[model samples]
Target: MMWTKCLCLLWALSALCAPVNKQRQRMLLISFDGFRWDYDRDVDTPNLDQMAMDGVKAQYITPPYLTITSPTHFTLLTGLYVENHGVIHNMWFNTTTTEKKPYYQTLFVNEWWDNGSLPIWITAQRQGLKAGSLHFPGTSSSYQGEVAMVREVEPILYNYKNETAWRENSDKVMGWFRDQDLDFVSMYFGEPDGTGHRYGPDSPERQEMVKQVDRTVGYIRHLAETHGLTNSLNIIVTADHGMSNVYRNGLVEEITLSAIPGFSFRDIAFHLVDFGPSGMLLPKPGKLETVYSALKGAHPHLHVYKKEDMPEHLHFAKNDRILPIILWADPGYVINGYFPVQFHKGEHGFDNQEMDMKPFFRAAGPAFRKNLEVGPFESVNIYPLMCHILGIEPEVNDGHLNATRNMLVTSTGTRGENRSILQNTLTGIAAVAGFLAVVFVVVTSRQILKRKRKDKRSGSVQHLPEEENTKQTGF
Candidate 1:
């Protein structure tokens, strides 16, 4: 009897951790770099509009701070803030040697990425699921000697604006799922970001690019159906960060470090600037105070912070990869170094709190509630959501499963039946455990009473209490 109770207890406990779905649904996570929250508002995005009608759509989703390509994307992959995950910059740098690797080159530098945390791809693969990546950041580099089971890296100077390439990538990824039996795959499209950077977010060129993106979105879903995966695969369409135009044409003075009255680049040991709206300066041993003062009040648009004094919400200052005297510009401003060398009409990497910094989120397919428009959620929460759909235990992550819970639906479920599988499972477990406890108590009490009345004729008095049975539900 003791063993039976123990076995039942163990079984209940194990069931609590079971994955949400009995059959793992395939996941396709797609990122359209620098796709702003409102990109569809002004454009005719019928495909995206239909996606909203067919699946769950967020009003918008917030990206982590350092809102650049690599860091925020890593936040999605790892569910950790930039500082915690340690990919603080898109361009990986070594402050010691002052050797910096450009964004594309950094993709191959294992040491630049594999800092204590692991991305979802590695996590899923390790948990008996096969995973693949198509030009996603952090895909090229191996994690603790394990890379994605399959991956593709774009060539240097690859044209990000190519629509045909996106379709081909989508077809290839679907093939990987059907042919290779892969459970998870992440795809990245470097568009609208490049278009936004070159022509500004408000330019007609960017609007045209957004149309291309919409077409690509519709095309991907069509391929999913053609591949016979529409009923079984879950798709997430999101971006790392959004784009904003760099203010120029005399509306405001550009922020130039060299143009400041007392500031001099000679005082800085190693500096990262002129990249975009965010930068950091490592002052020489004795030059810290002067350097900080020169840049502090130099311009109203420029914001400078000592590493220790950075805002807690940014979650960017703690990492060793970050240099001292970090700085950023107000939206529409870029930090210029010696001269205004960069002439891109648009930029990102601003504070995440800015509306322009937030990206869009859309999810669809078998596992999601249709036509559900959810409110904003942090991008970090996406990792746990993916883990839930994959039916795998999540790694230690900052994301909360409940943050995006309203989006999921079980098989053959309606909008009202959107409660999580784990919730239903636990409810049933509690009822059963309570029943077993009551039965044990009643039986023990009956035996004791009979023993006490042994002096008289042996008689048994029994009462069985009815319980409200709790049933498990499936979606």
Candidate 2:
């Protein structure tokens, strides 16, 4: 009885230790570049509106520091913030080189490339899954040993050149699905955003581009479904930042950080140049109040915040990368290019609440429950969500799975509980291994019995041959 019990225990342990058959799940993430939240609600986006109605939508999505393309894009892929991931800015001004390299230029550099720590693609690949990216920022060269299809920004994306490029881009993305099973595919569209910046957000030209983008989205959906992806392919549409029209009238105030006494600025908002719009100011000892007072006097429309006073939701204070002073721009204002003279029609990278700076998120897929609005979410949360859906582990994400849990299909029941899923998976694995062990023992016993039977037959034939030898002598 003791032996039986021991054997049973061995079986259970073996079952638990059995290898699991890995599954290949696929995901498709699409960034409509500059598609604003307002466009889905206001413009003719029948397909996109249906997507929102049938999918999960997040009310607000916050960008990581500087709220620029490279940093935010890296965050989505790696699940780390700008400070942690180290992309830092859209266009990094290297003081050492004294030459500016667009973020894409650093794609091949080992420091930033492999240092991402836990990029979504690398994580997926580690698990034996496949991923592909098309024309998204920060993916131009490769990272974590994955190369994505990426293109540099061109002046031509601003106007008529945009339509041709966009069509070509969409076609290329659609072609990727042919004969290939991928775990993830990411594509970016830069026209509507580029148009919004050049032609103003509310302009007729921008509105038309919005319509064009809608058509492109419809085609993408069609291609996804026709390829039998159906709802299995998760589609996430989001933006790096929102846009606000910066008028010449708004530039009445202008002041450089150097002009202020005992205050230093590594970077300042261009719109609030005179008063230093939405910025971080490191003040010399005993000069905080003086700098704050002078800033307020110089720019009354701006809202100033101490590091401790920043919004509780931004998660800003504890990290040193965030400068001591945070600046907020008044609605419809953004800072732009270098000193003195300049009038610009477009800008982003401002405080989260600026009318033109709010980002929206909409996601739909087999993993997502139909017709759900997801959050009041930050962009940081996106990294983890991507990892979860792809079945990859994330290493450096500040965001948690709970942040966007509502979008998941199993989010409500026992499956919705992550702990339950893990527990059940382990249980199933153990059961399978135990069953296999018992079958192995049975097969081995049968083979041994068959061998013994064959040996007995041969022994009987040998004894008969000895009798035949005697008969030959008698005959």
Candidate 3:
């Protein structure tokens, strides 16, 4: 009985300690800015192809509307729409301070980056796990007053001149995973995006950049294999958004805000323009109707909307950061006051529903299923999936685990099911132990009572025999 009780105690202790003894699951999220879904079809990416065959690949990952870098990337991290997260655009006017901050300038301000919803890294850190980021958006700012354990001190710069930067960053990330033992790590690459902008998406330069990016992937894979972490490490390669080619050779008419009648730049208190494919105007004081009417049908390729009347599907209307009037350009058109002498050959920041705006998503690791092709899912869904793989509870956000659950092996038998099974098994063992303990006590008590009765009866018989002998002798 004692042995049985001791065994039960040991089993309970082991069960309690199991999570602490198990190896921690590691995740690495990599983003290639402006990497379109079809870029792989354009270039040779054997490493990515093998990863897809070995793991899971999305048909396409749809980012939120106004598909720009900061907003979509932040959405992926936080699992919230732009309106909910408060990063309404890549560059928006901050009404609180009445200052206009562009994308690059917004990186330094906490107000622009720190939205209410916690990002995956911040959430992981809050749950006592370590996280690291290499130039990922939102890593630069503190979330709910907590920052990641490790992140780049300065904003990551795109060194087009230095081709070796990607490999170096990969090595740094691998070090964080293998040595620092970070639970989650995110890395960003500014490639193909830059190349696409400099020379259109279909240009040879963009294709070469794609190949170069693929080589970087191969480098990271080789490092993972060398460290015996290929199976243990979950690596996700995705992009913020995709790129679209813009017509800049006068093949298509240029649309500019300045061309609109009564739409003088002086009438705007603060505005966001000159950036391609979209524009936001905050009319000075009461020029709202005048500005809106002037820019409504100003160009054949442009579409204008009042902030409240913006498409509900875009989820971009409710935020205060969104200006009084929003502008969208067609796929091949660029929206600016004047065509620059040096304009980007390609651009983004259009309606996300367009196929050209879809980004690529591929993941490989122990947690993900093999060779699966799924999705046309919202990019926001990635947050919950990431939380599931890392074994952390996700925050309240716009994503659902069921959307991407099919991509994971454990999802076949749901996590709750596995947990219930474990609980049932442990409960059965405990119940059996308790039953044996009760039986041991009952049987032990019965044996003690029986022995005492036998001793008492034997003494009475011995005494009787002694008494009979004395009486017969009659001394």
Best by lDDT: 1
Candidate 2 lands at a TM-score of: 0.71
Compose the digit string of candidate 3's lDDT tens values, residues 261-303. Answer: 7788888877777888887878888899988888887788999
For candidate 1, the per-residue lDDT at 28 reads 95
**Can you write out model 2's per-residue Cα lDDT over 1-475, one digit (the tens) per residue?**
5446656866676565544443334577777665666766667888777787777877767776555566677777776766667665454443333444444565445555455455676666666666667666655545656654333333422443366677676666656655556667777776566777778787887788878877777777787777777745778888777777765554545434455554445332221233213445555556777766666544555566787886765445655435566665664554322353434456566665554666668787777778787557777888878777776666767888888877887633221234445677678766765766777777778889998898787876665667688999889
List where candidate 3 sits over 4 angstroms from the true fold. Answer: 1-23, 95-98, 153-161, 338-342, 411-475
What TM-score against the true fold does each predicted structure earn? 0.84, 0.71, 0.84
What value does the lDDT take at residue 225 in candidate 2? Answer: 78
Deviation in angstroms for 418 in model 3? 8.2
lDDT ranking of the models: 1, 3, 2
